[model samples]
Target: MPDSAGILPLPLFSSSLKRDTSRPVMLIGFQHQGNLGLGYLASTLREHGYSVLTCDFEAETSEIIESARQSKPMIVGFSLIFQFYIRKFDALMQALRAAGVDCHFTIGGHFPSLSHEETLRMLPELDSVVRFEGEMTLLELADVIGTGRDWHDLQGIAYRGTTGVVTNPMRSLVDDLDSLPYPERNFEPEKALGRKALPLLASRGCARTCSFCSIQTFYRTAPGKIVRTRKPAKVIEEMQAMHEERGISIFLFQDDDFPLFGPVWRRWAYDFVDCMHRSGLAQRVIWKINCRADAVEPEIFTAMRDAGLYLVYMGLESGNEEGLKTLHKQVSVEQNIRAVEMLKQVGLLFEFGFMMFDPGSTLESIKQNLRFLRTILNDGCAAAVFCRMLPYDGTPIKDELERAGRLLGDVCAPSYDFLDPRVSKMYNSLSQIVDVWGWIHGYRALSPQLNWAWNEVAIMERLYPGIDGLEEYRRRLAAVTKKSNDVLFSVMDNLLEVAEFDAAERWDNARLDALRREFLEELLRERDAFVEHNQSTMLRVLRAQPVQEAASA
Candidate 1:
């Protein structure tokens, strides 16, 4: 643990009150596809007569310092969602302080909320941490700071005092979500991937308590309802406003589980479609959502598609029954398969979140996952990638691993090696390949190509729907993408098998490196071919369209 003695003194809350209430309350967050958490907080703060400024993760340290200096916020709230970004946040805060930008600093979101004590100990620059749901908590804290009132008694906050760290009692969750203000719309039209996309949250919290998920733990610790949703009318109102005001034609629902609220979901779905139809935004704006496997139903998905649902991202987690049980997924492999079939039946594009390795993973479990991926791939379901299950802080898996002495690394980045040597070796090999070929190449190199294609498809669908061969072009591009992804996964599986055998025979590093490079080259070639084919086809489709349709599209 680092010493906090040399940390800078806390900014005077009294001085902050002298500033105009209209001065923005700056909130910082990571560069995710969309950060609705900060958006919600910003909107809530605005409702309470506090102005807000949101700085994304991509903002350089110098840019942040300049922004803060200009905004002159009384308090700056940092959204510490991922542990991996804590170090970056720490550096940014240090830079801000060194630059003489004095302000009260607070941190919130999953990481800080879950491990507030550790966070305070690690980051001395932060004044306090807002736990669980932050809307009301942050509003109250700002009021306290503005009025120079004692903040120690505030619930849902952990702060340092003369007596040391003081953690207040937990705050109750907001019961009527409809009462809350809609999240602020801060979308940059030019920066959006050719289509102005807005992230909307229909619900908060998940019904299932997966052992490896921090969200489940965060909600469990907070009082009140586990899963709360806004009224369908309110949801539609927000969407309509964005579409009509900002020309946002795409909506991405950032819900943990889109349709897992049981009977409430069916009614909500129907009402949502009804509202969309009434508002006429359904036909104008296409959307994507995240949900669980068991929540899938053919009828519901078909209705959603008709209401302009464009994509569905499902958390399949694992295919092996034992792996599912270990993770407490509460859904069977059959359920996952059924969900895929439902999406396919509805002709909806989809993606999956799969875990190929976990704490107790063995070669047999990995093999099962491979078979599962193969099944989905051959069925032409969607692009699926497998990752190792990370035992996030405050999760059941983290607690269990710590108790068993299997957990490694500090609280910020908890990791563990597999008990099975074969699994460990295979993972090491596959990870190397993924680092070079799958992760970096796929996200950095191939993502733009895919996003461009997606944007073109959305444009054609919206502006020139009656144009010839547009649907066929979409289908062909999707097929190429699916095939390309399948080949990548197949190569990964082969590399894992080869690594497992090589480990058993104690193969030399030179031999292993050579094999890895060979596989990587093959993957790169396959990826390039697919990207080129998609790009060429997209260009052809646009060029072949009638001049008026192309101009409009």
Candidate 2:
């Protein structure tokens, strides 16, 4: 039990028997992109003398059970990153329990942290939730569980109490992000054209309050500074170490909003760029970041480009003013266009998050969005992509929809209808079409594959510059991409027309499928040919050999 100061007294070790430190604490989560949340938690626990093991949640049930049977973990924690996976995780939890691995179960992430009551009710297997900013909280929970002490009074925890689900007071956010150790990377680094790419964070939280995003609210609800940044020197030091030790050449900044927000952070960005140059890493590595459209100013962005900024991902959530206003993006359509133009002007590549359909969307608005995509993507600077805005949990838009009694679907997959029923029909059909062909991971997706091929060309331009046919390869890839974009826009145009006339049934999907197939075949053939032609260069790059300038152009 905790004392009057609300802190638990140290657990006294038994004279005869001590807690077995061999029993590890297991963390299970979706490790598709190397989940930093679990990485930080594992590192934190290890820092305080605890053994940690992790398993991908997508692993087979039998495999997970086998691992648990072998490791015999004392506690099993789930990283419930998104609500969509709630049902899946519940199934895993049930399976683990049925296998007789009766360890203390716990979960964490945005959904469980924000809606603890519902989470507790949904996954009754959980012993507690290590809520927002889980490093210290999880560490404390591990200590108490290891020593067999009661943890009901622990801050930043929500558990099933006697009367109901009781959420204790939240812990303050970590003030100095630099104080925390680097995330323990257990998964393989992502590859961008034979160059190793790893995700890095320069800051913790975002300052903007986009209606559809819970990041701002997640940090604001906590009891500390909203956004905390590590010093540029420390960030460079980490980069230097990773580059020297791991041969990592690409860094993906996964900050919610990178520290390029306003005047204060502009200075930080400059300092970061300067550090990159001073540490001599500016020319050695390239990186990408996610930022708002309005944050893409010319001077700073160009400076960033000079300092290894290869790609920028802007949240251009909407095309028109009305849609932007509804999404609370606080930026105009012109600004979005200008941001793309500025990126192009400075010779930096970019991708964007565009919502073609929102709650207030109509046929006209959808068409406006289509035109906007054309405006930016006509040159084939990047792949054409768009998605319906999802009203995720703890977002203002979710609350707004709930108050108006328009929110539909289950909590795991919440959705709503557009204002017009015809628009709904249109979107429903469009979504099916996209899922078939244009979706990033769709079976027939062509644009993203081409986009990746183009990314390889770009990477080669930097790392293997002056290769014999690099320029020609880039030009051919660009032409193929522009043609693919043309096909996408044509299909969208036909869909819009069909929806307007209420003839979605008559929409010729066979013709579109044939076109996508042709492009996909061509893409594969072209990529294979290029690889065969550049066999020596490809082999050298794939083997991670030192880059050497070719004899001649």
The candidate that wins on lDDT is 2
TM-score of each: 0.84, 0.92
Q: Which ranges in model 2 have alpha carbons more than 4 Å from their true place?
A: 1-22, 432-434, 437-444, 502-506, 538-553
Each model's lDDT = 0.74, 0.82
lDDT score, candidate 1:
0.74
For model 2, how many clashes?
0
Instruction: For candidate 1, list the clashing residue pairs, or say none.
Output: none
lDDT per residue as tens, model 2, 1-553: 3334333333333334233344579999988778989988898777656689999998898999999999988899999988998989899999999999998998989998888888999997889988899998887777667767787898999999889988899999999998888988888888755578888889998889799998887898889999999999999999987787787888889999889978999999999999999998898888889998889999999999888988888999888888999989899999999999999898777878888889889889988998999899887667777778899989999999999998999889899977788788777776666544453445347767877786676677666553567667766777777787787777678777877885545435566677777777877888778766876775565455433211100
Off by over 4 Å in 1: 1-23, 189-194, 379-381, 436-442, 445-463, 470-479, 503-553
What lDDT does candidate 1 reach at residue 67? 92
| lDDT, residue 438, candidate 1 | 29
lDDT of 1 by residue, 1-553 (tens): 1123211112333433432254468999874676778888999877666779899867788898999988888789999878877888888889989988677899998889889988998898998999998998888787777656667788899988788888899989888888888887674633332346768888888878999999988888889988888888899998877765666667888888885447878788888888988888776678888988888888888888888887888889898999999899999998998888788778776777888889878778878888887777674334456678998988999999999989998866779978988777777766554443422235543323443455455555653344456555656656655654565566556756675665232334454445445544444554445445555544665466444433433
